[model samples]
Target: MHCQPDYKHEVYIWLKSNQMCLLCDEATHSAATLCNTCEIDLPWLTDGCEVCALPLPISGLVCGQCQRSPPAFRQVVAPWTYGFPLDSLISRFKHQGRWPLGQMLASLLRQCLQDRFDNAELARPDRLLPVPMAAKRLRQRGYNQAAMLARWLSRDLDLPLDEHLLLRPHDTVAQQQLDAKQRQRNLLKAFALAPGAQVQGQHLALVDDVLTTGATAHSMARLLMQAGARQVDVYCLARTPKPGT
Candidate 1:
């Protein structure tokens, strides 16, 4: 599910400026590595279900699935659909340890959140929580991509990052290729709240690389709400479209 990145492509993200675009190799006259043209061409999610961020034909409409059974999270805020160079970049950052790419994406995501905040379209969460990865997978990958993103977002957004507030003690069968129902079943008991976590009445955001089926986010949000959290929202790099849509 991951790859080894070419060493030549790696860069010390913060220490570098006037960077080359990761996708096009154009000189980006900014601290961010992505060039403006490539950023414009990325798969921006202009319209989606307000609650789930499931790709929809219009911007503010709730999908039938959310209407039938509302998810625990209040909203899913993602800036892009899972497609194209964005997907490839995420794969490299997530699976191949290309952290500079991850940082670039997180910076863009921060911009999205900031715009929403300025327009009163989103409420700032009390805490940012990365989706807890299973220990086995964490060991194999040498990092949790979600946590890395959360760290960067926390720094940029001046939000609290709780890396240990949630725990994923064990691994499950891969959720890829599984339908929504099966994915939910696979994630049952996949997460736990850490001892003494003070989640009560706290608005929290779950950070992850991508939102696919919404199964994982739903499960985790339900867990937090059951434990007395006030609200939950999802913050991720991209959202996959509904199947066949």
Candidate 2:
């Protein structure tokens, strides 16, 4: 079931009280409008493999790379291909210090969830977990984009958002520079459950802004299942389609 935005008058009041710029504030602008600079300069994933969400030929459902070796996550859904205006929007939300875009992006992600659940034989997760960031990154960024998205999604989906259930234990090299195997290895042991965390018999949905290599989501999902989650689903605002397609 999908809920329309209420656009509470308090939303604007809260924005003003927080001294946040609805369009330019560091937290949510990516949710409102993309800045001119980032709108033109950001890198985008134009074409990608369907299974892994890596750029690929548009003709096949699963690319050769995924056929040879599959990822751990069961399925993935993204609203837009990671390209152009969308890429710029993400870059600003991620790198340019705009955090509010997280909310806007979450709105988009909510729509994707509604569509997928409406059209497919998918199970709705009981909980939503954001792909966590390392302590250092969290401090530097002042917020986790995934967590921000998860918070809003929780409101939209009426599911509890468990922010502390999972955490990134160690910082790893950027996955963008790694190959499939290297990407998996780099993220290995990078995430772990928080002390005394419990997810027994629950369904979990992992949220992230972008699905690049599926390495990070795979690692996180494994941990969630180890903690007793019965099922896991992956959600992102954009998927980097394989290179050619």
Candidate 3:
């Protein structure tokens, strides 16, 4: 009797979880690690600004901010709102080096992007460009999160990735802590085109892990257009909710 420690259920649960829902650590039959239940419950963006993808109360309409001064990009597409679990997961993925979390987010983005294509919400871009990171940041982080996401998207969408075209000349102060004006000024001349990299008339989509305040995306889009890109569209994992939303 002392030899039987009742470990049967624990072993069964562990085996089931390995083959099942990664979110709740429960048994399931889904091929994806994240079960349908968890996916459905994620803070999926329902309505957002047409131009910037900022979470909004209405759909199919541009927000006041975009109207006042439109973004350089033609459109922005983000699947989820940056809140709760997504925020925590992104934090772990970006800062804590949790690759699986990034992979899960990228897989979900692929599915969401398909739905967008089916609904004709977005058109396939000619090329994908991950937001450039400074050399120092890249070395410090060991990987650029945007580039990783873009690589995943390239495989999923069969789109070519052109990271060589864009270059960050220097590391600017983090944009999160700055106001809109300061963020814009901080990024001035921070990005530059690689010598002889052609972008004329190319419809490019810039990819990143998150869109906060739209400052960085706008800056990048502007740079692309200045280099003769016909259009730039933004793709991100999540869009931070409008302040106080």
Q: For candidate 2, write residues 104-140 as lDDT tens digits.
A: 5676568657776788746678888888888876776
Which is the winner by lDDT between candidate 1 and candidate 2?
1
Give one digit per residue, the lDDT tens place, for model 3 in 1-245: 12112333543454445466656877666446677788888899999999898888878889999999998999988999998778888988798776667777988898888788789967888999999888877777777888878887898888899977889999989888898899989989898889998899999999999998888888889988988999999999999987776
User: Per-residue lDDT for 60-153 in model 1, tens only?
Assistant: 7999999999999999999999999899999998887877888889999999999999999899999999998888887777788898899889
TM-scores for every predicted model: 0.93, 0.75, 0.90
Model 3: colliding residue pairs: none
Ranking by lDDT: 1, 3, 2
The clash count of every prediction, one per candidate, is 0, 28, 0
Model 2: lDDT equals 0.70
* lDDT of residue 103 for candidate 2: 59
Best by lDDT: 1
